[model samples]
Target: MDRVLSADEIRWIHDFLELKDITYYDVQVEIVDHLASLIEAKWAAGSRQSFEVLFFEVFKDFGDHQWRQLLGAKQKGVWRQVVRNGVSIFLNFFTWPLVAYTFLSFLLIYTFLLAVPNAVNYLQESMYLWGFIVLVTWGYVIYRRPAKRAFLAYDGFVTFLGIDLYLVGWILPDFFAIFSERFSATPNGMLGLAAFYSLLVLVILTFSILMRIKGVQQFYKTYPQLLITQ
Candidate 1:
């Protein structure tokens, strides 16, 4: 029987991947397991190769790109997952009991803006307020959260979620100000497609944050190390 890899050896593999910038925990873990299995198999084949020798051989199999392909694969997968999760969240609001509340919320927003003497002015200001609020709240959450498992959030989905929110919050008002000034007079230019897309992005970011928080339980079930019990 071949000798199994030690804990330190596994961590070495992780560090190697990290050095290659494969920092996402999910991607790192997957690749580590794969390399371990290959290394052990090589060892069992009576090859007198050291860990470094075999590690290089395995890594080289993925071409000169190192871990970039794997990293890209994980990023792409996470993006797809984020999109799917967003769609599900979007649909949930328009279905069954929540639909009524969603409608009421829409109506309230519509009424509040329509009732204002200068609706566009209020909107421009409100976008800034909303952006500021989003930036502070999410920036605080990300700043305070322990980083031991930050890699777990590195799947790119949650990271991008927070990033998009922070950016949207910081930039939306400026965007609205510019767009409303230049294009508001045009027949179809109430809010450009860009602003409309930004609205959908905000919705995705909001739901993505919620998913990541609620997702902690699911992840913790699989990776108990994620839970920082104090």
Candidate 2:
């Protein structure tokens, strides 16, 4: 018969992970299950091993990076999933009222561009403000929210937010400007296109954060013990 791990024993193992710097909730859940199963097996075999001894032994098998590698793995997984979800959302915009809305909005903007010389400037400012707002909001969420759960999703958002800020505020604009100048593209046209894409990128990033929030909600539903009041 396998030995059942006590609550205290399980908590002790969880603390050991924190000591190893594996603070992310998802990683904690994985390593805790792993340690419990292995420890139970060893206990059933009649080996008198201390939990601490077994715990360090398990961590030792993971090499020098320790449990920090777990964070990297979780971050990579979340990043890919967020990107896939964002692409799906973009593709879905081709359907229904979304398509109609997109077309009408572009038409309205184009008409305004013809009438208003300053329209491009306003659009560019809006794009910069969009990126800046999201970056700051996310930064504040991470700062003010006491980290009681996995930071993989939060860190993942911050990582892409940095890229979005750079792309919107500088890189993409410069790239498009270069191409526009080479081909003698209209300044307004290039500015409009750049702003449109920058806004699109921000929308995708916002949706990705929404998905992450939904995942966290589901996690709490599944493991009520892990739920922390927001």
> Top model by TM-score, which number?
2
What is the Cα root-mean-square deviation between model 1 and the actual structure?
5.5
Q: What TM-score goes with each of the models?
A: 0.66, 0.66
Report backbone clashes per prediction.
1, 0
lDDT of 1 by residue, 23-51 (tens): 66666777888899998998898888888
Worst 10-residue lDDT window, candidate 1: 193-202
* Candidate 1 Cα deviation (angstroms), residue 160: 4.2
Off by over 4 Å in 2: 1-3, 57-72, 132-146, 157-161, 172-225, 228-230
Residue 109 deviation, candidate 1, in Å?
4.7
For residue 151, model 2's alpha carbon misses the true position, in angstroms, by: 3.0
The digit string of per-residue lDDT tens for model 2 on 107-223 reads 666666556765555654565666676567556555643356655554554444555556566765575445434532475665466446434544444554554454444344444
Clashing pairs in 2: none
C-alpha RMSD by candidate, in order = 5.5, 4.8
